[model samples]
Target: MKIAYTVAPGRGDTDLLLFGLSRCLLEKDVRATGVVQINAARDDAGPCDMDVKVLPDGPVIRISQSLGREARGCRLDPTALERAVGLVETRLAASVDCLIVNKFGKHEAEGRGFRTAIAEALSADIPVLVGLNRLNAEAFHKFSGGLATELPPNIEDLACWMTSVTAAKSSTA
Candidate 1:
């Protein structure tokens, strides 16, 4: 039941998205933690009743790791970057149950930091639920093309997605 929500720089309201998704799960009596990018500001002290684990220095590590991975097979030293990525993944796994990709907004795919993290999350087998914004629907359609379905706008959509996926996984298990 773990998930990871990733986002590109200057993307959506990751904290709010995480809070809203966690809130929806709470209403359904499902316990879930919202993992937001480390260092993002949030006013989650309101009505939502769910756990929030903010990665304290996610952005810095994301950059360092991305550079490291990119440098691999090149003349540059990649050891530091490898350690950075490993640290991020380790910390992410230690804190949250799953990862939510919170940055599927307009022009998000252009970010190297975000893209690299998504790759790492996938390699780690962390389930990624991409949250989209209205401003980027057209762009998303163009990018996702035939693979994308029209998702209802809002964090509640996560409930439906999670339920169906969990059911399928359970059936297979």
Candidate 2:
């Protein structure tokens, strides 16, 4: 089953949650792959964006940068984003136990970002865990056909779900 951690904006430590969960699952010998956002330091200059890192200790690649302009927004590098997604796709092709994507944000709501990678994982019958906020919850539901479970942003809950799904898969195997 596809699962998503429903986190409120700025309320939950999503990066830490994803990192910890990935580490826990890896310790269990489950082959998992995905991307997580790592925040870089911000100074008086402005807000530094985030780096997209592959799960299970892959290289960290900067994908967004604050573009100081009339309309201030982070400039996302499509090439870098695609490369990160490609890494996930490569891992999925090798048949992993689970896939954990960072978030279903603007790009995803617009049918971009890791949308394709998520679909590929689901099509491979791999359980997916993603971070989603209220703004995009509806879109996520519509995209997943209600197959995604909204999980609390807690390690215990996530670990439990992972155990259950992996166990079920193991039994069937």
Candidate 3:
């Protein structure tokens, strides 16, 4: 099971990193599946709107809600996020070289989000990569049974890891 995760210091840095990494993998003709978040800034200067695009090709779905400007809690739209997860699950059922989840976030930590899909990919021997943070680190570690490789949070490192894993898969097959 080739499972790896990374954490970026800046907000949205990991999201952008995965997005670029997926695109690069596609350019190299790898079948990278799953979702990467794209954040759009709000005109009102409130929190950015979050959308997840199903990888390879996409049906972008908004996973963030517009809570009142004064509100200060999570703006995640659970239904929308589940919708994105459904889309990713469909893609995962097909042959994929890798699965790139934007984050192993609150939902996943609670065993609700892409947790199942991630496990399924590993079971099928497809490489899995995800963005994770300190908040969810312990939960994710437990979920992975301490097998998840921690990659440095940078494009070069990520790309190299992907290349190595994909090449390893290729040779094994």
Candidate 4:
């Protein structure tokens, strides 16, 4: 079954939560793959853009670039995002226990972004954990056909869900 966690809109901690949860799972030896967004460091005191880093210290790809001195107008690189999705697909084919996608945002809602990758993982019967917000909750519901579970931004809750799902999968195996 597919599962997702929804963070409230404007709550800027989704990325951090994903990263932390992935780290926790890694410590327990769960095989997972996906990209997580990290804040870019500025040298000359300018606006910082976001970078997508493959989990567990893989390559970092710049997904957004600062449009101007203001940090408000960052532009997402479509090519970079596509490349990231491709990488995730490759990982999914390698038989991971779970997939941790960064978010099911605008592109996913419109059948873009990592939508195909998400579907591929589900088809492989791999549990997926993705970030979602109120804005895209309806779209996600429609896309997931009500099979997705909305999880709060709590590590314990996420861990518990993961444990249950993985346990069930193992039993069936």
Which predicted model would earn the best TM-score? 3
- lDDT scores for all predictions? 0.44, 0.79, 0.92, 0.78
lDDT of 2: 0.79
How would you encode candidate 3's per-residue C-alpha lDDT over 27-103 as one tens digit per residue? 88989889999999999998899999899899899999998899999999999989888888888888788999999
- In what order do the candidates fall by lDDT, top score first? 3, 2, 4, 1
lDDT tens string, model 4, 1-173?
66676584554588877878888888887777887777766786775567877765568888886676655643887788888888888877785778787888888898998898888878877788888877788898898989898887877788677767766776787
lDDT (10s digit) by residue, model 1, range 1-173? 23323232344455466556755655665433223423332264322222223233243322112233224432212353344444545655553334444445333444432345544554554444655655655554454443444444456666677656545544665
Candidate 4's C-alpha runs over 4 A off are: 8-10, 41-47, 70-74
All-Cα superposition RMSD per candidate: 10.5, 2.0, 0.8, 2.0
lDDT of 2 by residue, 36-134 (tens): 888776675466567978976798889875666443654787788888988888878885788888888778878988898888877766788888877
Best by lDDT: 3
Better of 1 and 2 by lDDT: 2
**Which 10 consecutive positions of candidate 1 have the poorest summed lDDT?**
61-70
The predicted structure with the larger lDDT, 3 or 4, is 3
